[model samples]
Target: MKNFDTDVAVVGAGLIGSATALALRQRGVAVVMLERDLGGSRASGVNFGGVRRQGRSPAQLHLAARAHPIWADLKAKIGIDGEYVRSGHIKLARSQADLTALAAYAARVADFDLGLEILEGRAFRERYPCFGPEIIGGSFCPGDGQANPRLVAAAYAQAARQAGCEVIERCPVTGITREGDGFLLRCGDAVAVRARRLVNAAGAWGAGIAAALGDDIPMRFDYPTILVTEPLPPIVSVNIGIEGGGFYGRQVERGNLVMGGGFGVASGDGASRPDSGALARIGGRAAAILPATRHARVIRIWAGIEGYTADKNPFIGESANVPGLFHAFGFSGGGFQIAPAVGEVLCELICEGRSSTPVEAFRPDRFQQQSAEPGRTP
Candidate 1:
């Protein structure tokens, strides 16, 4: 039997788990991270790589702000740049109503010091002439940007390993249960891991882990479709998103355009792929927004499995019923930008008994309280 022991066992080797492992090791804690599949093969690698503070819920702004510096120093942390750019993010407004809504959102988040610039009419066209005339205006957050999802998680995993954290790939924990004063993770009789604490960072399978621990959080799966086009002269300058949330895209320095929106297909075994119908819809919207993409050939299309909660927020604290068991999943598709800060928060919670960052809104018991209320469904 392959038996191992550690101070903390982290399930999932995605960016969040890997970063947490690295952070723990930096603080002189023993960490062993387990992944069912290759690290970053899921949502962490397949996401559109939007590292932005724009178009996020107010509750997430603090976390996003906290993660900005981490992205700034990512190369020093992981030894690779990860193709991250602070190229700014613009949320397009197709109509006057959309512009008004964007303005209102900017006003609501003004206290966060995001420095959102609202451009409309002649000023908007002059600022972003590449967009179609239909896009009346947009709200630009200069601090927001994009990164290469494919390279980030693996880099962090390697960095964690270098820092003395045991990262085991393809070691799926089939079941987890309390053993004495610690937790026992069983890998289908092939391996067993014992740890004083556990971190549920599994991307799509996180709900099952929480359920096993009696958290029973309400979460559903999503397959977000992303497509990339053949290399061409760069036309779009920054990451783009629609105000109403139908489409979003960005162009890499190599001149390939990455666009994503709409749900795709997910299999029973957790595999996912881009749906043809969704791709067609995205194509029509892309052509409408950016005429330059009308003739660009799409070279690849893919989708990743993500767990989303009803309120569209994530659970990022210790479990309500299970002590020493931390929950950090259910990001509802916006986890990438805030993942670094989340790793720091998880480390603080594990090593120091609490996180200095404000995470009261992400308490694991929030949904449980809602479920307990009359006429409320989790």
Candidate 2:
């Protein structure tokens, strides 16, 4: 066996794993990342890339807040543009109920240091004439923005390589076994990795890894369908979403309008394909929100699988049953925004046994009534 040794072995070289490897290497730890395919070919590469904190749940607000600065400085840190633009994010309220919910959320997050502007009626129309008349009100966060998901994970992997981290692509981890003081991972019978610590950043396929280590997290797969319209005049300057998340969209600098909503079809191997019905619904909703999009022709459509936990919050922290095993998955379609921060936090957990950021609520055993007993072998 071609055996390699490292202080940490990260499975799944998506944004979280690549970022974790980069952080660990920067901290002088030996890190090796293994991926099933080319890095970021899954959810991380295909996400909508809305780097916003305005609509996050209370438990994820802190992580999102901490991640905002990272996105702003990503080009400087990773040496890649990733097309990051802080064009602001606006969530439209289509009804009185939606407006009330936006107001309540704005009040709830007021102390969180996010400067939110509540626009309604005349203010909404005057500020954003591009939106349709159906939008009664909206909440805007000037700092929230968008980025290019297709480039982020690969950039992180490059930065990790530059920091002396070993990244192995197209090496699927077939089996994992606890060996002495560490773990032995078999990668498709060609390579073996022994590491004192393991970080499972396996996006939608995370539950299988957790189950192998005696932790059964209730994770479901969601395939969000996305469609892009043909190039048009630059009408949208900010990322747009609905209050209840029925639809979300943004226009690229090249004038293509990208939008996604609803679920798609998932294959047996966890891969996903765009659903025609879902794409149609998203286009209809997009037109309703912005009349200018009513006649835009859809140029392309796609979908990818994302892991969603029962509570819609990610499971980030050490394993309850297994020693030296960590997890950072189940972001429920919101991982793109906070992936870098998650990597930093995971590095803290692996190196120091604790993270400075508050991750208590995202523990792997939170869904269980009692923690699983240790000593279970993979």
Candidate 3:
């Protein structure tokens, strides 16, 4: 059996894992990243790439606020463009009720210094005429934007590699065993990895990893479908989303509009593809938001499996049942934007034995209290 040793063993080379590995290596921690497929081939590489804090849950605002600066300087730190653009993010409201919700949300996050601008009626139309007449008002966050999901995870993994981190692609961890204050990770029956610390950044497969270590987190897999239209003249300047999550879309520099809504189907083993019927519904909604999209030819449509926790918040920080093991997963669909900050947080937890950010609400054992109840697992 082939054996290797490292200070940290990170499973799943998605954005979170790659970012964590990169951060750990930068701190001089010997790190090894194991990927089931090519790094970032899953949800991390195939997400909507909205790097916004406007529509996040209250629990996520703190992390999102901390992540914003990191994202702003991502290109400089990663040595790649990653197509990150701070073109701003606008969430439209179709009715007075939706507008009220936006106002309440803006008020709630005011203390966080988000500076959300609320626009209505003539002001909204004059600033953003790309929308259909149905849009009544909107909330805009100038600092929030979008990035290229296809480029980010792989870029972090490559950067980690250049910084002396070992990244093992196509290596699926089949079993894990405790070994003298460390972990013995078995990939198939041949390769073995012994590490003093472990990070479960497995995205949709994270629940299983947590369960293996005796922490049964309630996580569900969701397959969100995304559609890309052929390049058109730039019309939508800001990343757009409708209140209530009816639809969301953004135009890249290449002029193609990437949009997504609704869920698709996935196989038992987690292989997923876009649902034609769902894609049709998404296309109709996209055209409704921007009529020009009705004429734009769709060039690609795909789906990826992402984990969603019961409360729609991620599980971060160390495990309660196991020592020297940490978890960061179940961002629902928002992990891509805050992944870099999460990596930094993980590094702090591992290296300094605590995080500077207030991550108490994201503890891995939060679900344990809910799971203790009979016939229900939150």
Candidate 4:
């Protein structure tokens, strides 16, 4: 029954939502952060939390390199322990094709001067003895790192709250209606939150929120599960053992290995349960790359759904047809690293009506125009 009239209303209090709220508040904007449940209770709490730049497309790598510093800045500004470890990232090569891919990716980033090295064969083994005999070379990005995703979400929510933003927990937005140069968010059971502008940060359920506002966002949600192994002696320096779409994991500060890949057991729609079989299969690959993992028991497994757009980018900025409606979804799996920059960009768009960063790469209209009339030119 809380009636809120603010400068901005942000739906979904995950990393992006919370960060956007914090940014807007920093600029003296009145922000209301609405969470269906609580912040970080979903994917924000469940992701691998790897703030990495390696293995990213050229565009993403450039943005991540910039976003890395913003994370540190946020950590320092908020005094929140998001576990901002600036550990280097490594992508191991189990096959020749993997080696080639790493080499090509290295060449691509040469312009950014990312300080990476291509280690191969015996040299790679000499650098990392923990891997199995079948191991090959690897590409290492010294600047990449990892952070606790849950901690980031918490810090943003707290900072936003401290900066005069209203954070509403357990409020699911039932619908959105447009007002003059603003919008009103309909919570269930006659509850409503109003604001001059509205941001859609619903993550996996973001597309539904868009539709609720009579705007159809072309995106889907896919849930993936990952598991962690019991702490073992530090066998690998950084995360290792990945190929094709298959992935490996990095060892965390707690000494446990957090692992996941593009490959996993297919759970039904909106599934959030962890699947041991998927972990077992991924663990088999981990053992194949580094035999030592076989001895480590899997302690826990978890799952969270992430948004995927028709294009491989995100959907930031105001919706094309819906005035005062903003969306920050469609990050695919690369949201963790670029989230800070995404927040910064979104904050600029919300405050100044545009961002310095080239948001054209992540525009919501990108998907809509893909199937438009041939000469309609986006």
Q: In candidate 2, what are the lDDT values of residues 144-259, reduced to their tens digit?
A: 99988989878887898889988888899999889887889999778999999999999888988888877887777778888889998989899999988879999999999999
lDDT per prediction?
0.88, 0.88, 0.88, 0.77
TM-scores of the candidates are: 0.97, 0.96, 0.96, 0.92
What candidate 1 gets wrong by more than 4 Å, as runs, is 369-378
Predicted candidate 4 versus true structure: per-residue lDDT over 220-282, tens digit per residue: 666666778998887765745354656668788778888887423336644556566666678
Question: What's every prediction's RMSD, in angstroms?
Answer: 2.6, 3.4, 2.3, 4.0
Which candidate would rank higher by lDDT, 2 or 4? 2
Quote model 1's TM-score.
0.97
Segments in model 4 whose C-alpha atoms lie over 4 Å from true places: 262-271, 369-378
User: 1-378 in candidate 3: lDDT tens per residue?
Assistant: 778999999999998998899899889999988998998899999999999888887778878988899888887768887888888999999999999999999988888887799999899989888888788889999988999888887898888888888888988999998999999999997689999999999988888898888888877777989999999998987999889986999999899999998778875565888888999899999888898888899999888888887777899999988999999998888898888889999999999999888788899888776642221111
Residue 204 in model 3: lDDT = 85
Q: Which lDDT tens digits does candidate 1 get at residues 70-144?
A: 999999999998999999999999988998999999999999999999999899888888898788899999989
TM-score of 3: 0.96
